[model samples]
Target: MTVIAQLSDIHVRPHGVLYQDAVDSNAMFSAAVDSLNSNRPEPDLVVISGDLTDEGTVDEYQKLRELLARLRQPFVVMPGNHDNRGNLRAAFPDHPWLPGEGSLSFARDVGQLRLVALDTSVPGLHHGELDAASLAWLDDELTVHRDQTVVIFMHHPPFMTGIPYLDIYGLRNADALAMVLARHKNVDRILAGHVHRSMQTRLGNVPVLTCPSTTTQIALRVEADAQPASFLEPPAYMLHRWTGRGQPAVSHLCYVGRFEGPLPFA
Candidate 1:
């Protein structure tokens, strides 16, 4: 089985403060990284969905690179509203698939899965949208890799999570994205971040999952007028296990900190 560990919304700040002193995102991300590296069955790869930095600043991206350098497994990143494409490309020059300008998107093959990173960030805007260019590129890529199971990773979810405050900042062109996704029968799952909460839903037969942030989690308030608030819930990440062909992919939500376990179920 190919184990792909996913961490999202790390939100590391250059000065080490995030969301108005709610949590130290850098430290939390470090802890999460350690946990993943030390996992009993080490993951084959790692994917950070988005929001690697609280602010899309040079200093912030530098710090994020430093933190990610400690990771043992190979990793890839996408862009969120909180990220700057230019800064990311500058920091990771080796990622040739990342365009120097425009949306940062790429595809990589991980075992039996074709991992596609889609950039949904809109410059100077909090809301996200997959533009025509990006959708077209994705369609072509899916067409070329029709035989491989595709798992899409993006910062913003294509579906609303019922939290009115956050929903306003969700993917603005979800219908367009759904249309592109519908034609791709090989798309196995869509993994996203930005909600800072773990969520599960579907967009046209494809499973979409949002991972919780490594620092804080958005409070689950479904009221129409609900406001945005975050809590110091245990930071977590998601592990996706793909067992080659003829088997379904499985995802597990894992908490970062330590807990007593494996002490004999009998």
Candidate 2:
């Protein structure tokens, strides 16, 4: 089975923007969809990495759900710091992803491959955590699917990306997470969001992929004094291709190309 499409930090508009990056969240999401729809090999699944709503309000979640409903295929989701679990459940009451108690933990089968979604959203907090329950569930899920290639999704980056701002908000219980992963050999990749920028690293031998936000992005600043986040770039998504065979899973950083001042797709 081939897995494709990942977008994050849609940060819906008319909402709050306490921090930096003010790129009309709605426009960013629109551009992200345009990029996805125009792609040649359309994705089988869209895994939105998190930050579905900016203010974590019921209205914002409703709006966010409506926008996501416009997508062409089936999609799974988790939450970032910006998302409120109550609001998320209220928006998509009928969704199978509902009732996320700090760990939505979705286990669905798409062909032979298994997709698992883990919740890292902590109420009223910026940093993320898995807790013991989520980690235990993950362990159990992988225990059953040891032979199949499983892909895990969460909102917080488990590995460091060098950006101080994002690094501080990285997964808090990463060691607990790593211990779980160390026991499971079936996990193919760990897909994450929340950095608002693209980053990649390895946890042991497992590949960890961080997709850029569908809204604005933060510049890669390894400098001591970095400017607050900027909104100079367009939105984007990620595409993961996995055909259960000799072929390995592949991921793409898809540019949604949506921004305040736009241009044509080349």
Candidate 3:
């Protein structure tokens, strides 16, 4: 079995700074890291989907790099709408998978599972979209990896989440992405992180899910006129356990922070 730990929307702040002059995102991320280190069924890979920084700044990335050095597991990162591709690439010069130019997308194998990371971030915009080249790349990858269970991870989900404010900045060319995905059936699931809350949906006939942020969670409001807001929800992440080909992968939500004892059942 292979276990992949997914942490999303870190929004790391600049050194000695608090995110938005309010939440201490850096501390929250550190706590999350500690939680992962002590977690059972130690993960083989850690995937940080996006929103790596509150602002796409050099200082932020530098601070983020410093924080990530404490993580014990091997990990991969992709950009989100809040990230600057060039800065991100420069900060992680060791991650050769990130392309020298254009979107940061790559397909790599972890154990028996094929992990395909798509770059859905749009420059200078909060809404996400995939260009023609990226779509072509995805289609080609899916075609070549048909025999393996492929799990697509990106910063933005390809479906409307029904949250009024969030949907306003949702993926713009979702139809185009869906079209490309419809051509391939090897995709076991699509994972994302922009929503800052756990959500589930479907695209291209495959299951899609969003991971909760390690900092805050977006309020779950489906009303059409709901306002955009965030809350101090408990920091959390997902542990995706893949047993093998014949069996479906299971995802468990794990919360960060100390809690009361796990007493025996009465």
Candidate 4:
């Protein structure tokens, strides 16, 4: 069995600042890293979906790097709308997967699973789009790794989550992405961030899941004109376990705080 831990929207602060008004994003993220590091059975890898910083600043990224360095398992990160591609690449020069100056996209093989990271951030906008080049790269990568179970990682959810305020900034070229995914049968799941809530949906035959932010969660309001809002809900992360071929993958939403439980039912 191969287990992968997914954490998103860490939103690290510059120095001594809280996200929104209540969330100490830095503290929450530190706790989350500790949880992942101490998890039983241990995860093979950890993937941070995106939004590593609140403002995509150098100080924030530096702090993020410092905090993540404590993890025992290897970790990989993609960029979100709040991220600057050039800064991210500079912060991690060893990450050859990141291009010199374009969208950061690449594929890595771990055990029997093929992990594909896609850059959906649209330069200067909060909304995301998969440009022609990104789409082409995804298609080719999926085709080349057609025999292995592929999991996609990106910053944006390709489907709407009914949160009107958030949806307004949703991915713009979801249909185009769906077309590419439709041709690829090896894609087992598409993992994403930016939604700041735990959500599950389907894109074509592939399962698409969005992880809750490690910093804060957006309120789940469905009104068409709902305003942007966030809550101090307990931060969480996701664990995905693949039990070899022909078996369905299992996912668990893990809260980042300690809670008294696991007591045996009488």
Best by lDDT: 3
| CA error at residue 231 for candidate 2, angstroms | 3.8
Which lDDT tens digits does candidate 2 get at residues 104-165? 66788866778888988788889988888888889999998888888888899898777777
lDDT of 1 at 69: 87
Model 3 poorest ten-residue lDDT run: 242-251
TM-score of each: 0.96, 0.89, 0.97, 0.97
**Could you arrange the candidates by TM-score from highest to lowest?**
3, 4, 1, 2
lDDT at 231 for candidate 3?
95
How well is each residue in 106-188 modelled by candidate 3, as lDDT tens digits?
88999899999999999999999999999999989988888888999999988888898998888899899889888887788
Off by over 4 Å in 2: 15-21, 100-102, 225-227, 258-266
Order the candidate numbers by lDDT, best to worst: 3, 4, 1, 2
TM-score of 4: 0.97
Question: Candidate 3, which segments miss by more than 4 Å at Cα?
Answer: none
Task: Put down candidate 4 lDDT per residue, 1-266, tens digits, no spaces.
Answer: 88899999999987788876567899899999999989998999899998988888899989999998888888888999998888888899877767777888888987779999999998779999999999999999999988888889999999988889998899998999999998889888999999999999999888999999998799999987788888889999999999987565788999999898879995
**lDDT score for residue 10 of model 2:** 80
Per-model root-mean-square deviation over C-alphas: 1.3, 3.6, 1.2, 1.2
TM-score of 1: 0.96
Which residue pairs in candidate 3 have backbone atoms (N, alpha carbon, C) closer than 3 angstroms, thus clashing? none
* lDDT (tens digit, per residue) of candidate 1 on 83-106: 888898898887777777888888
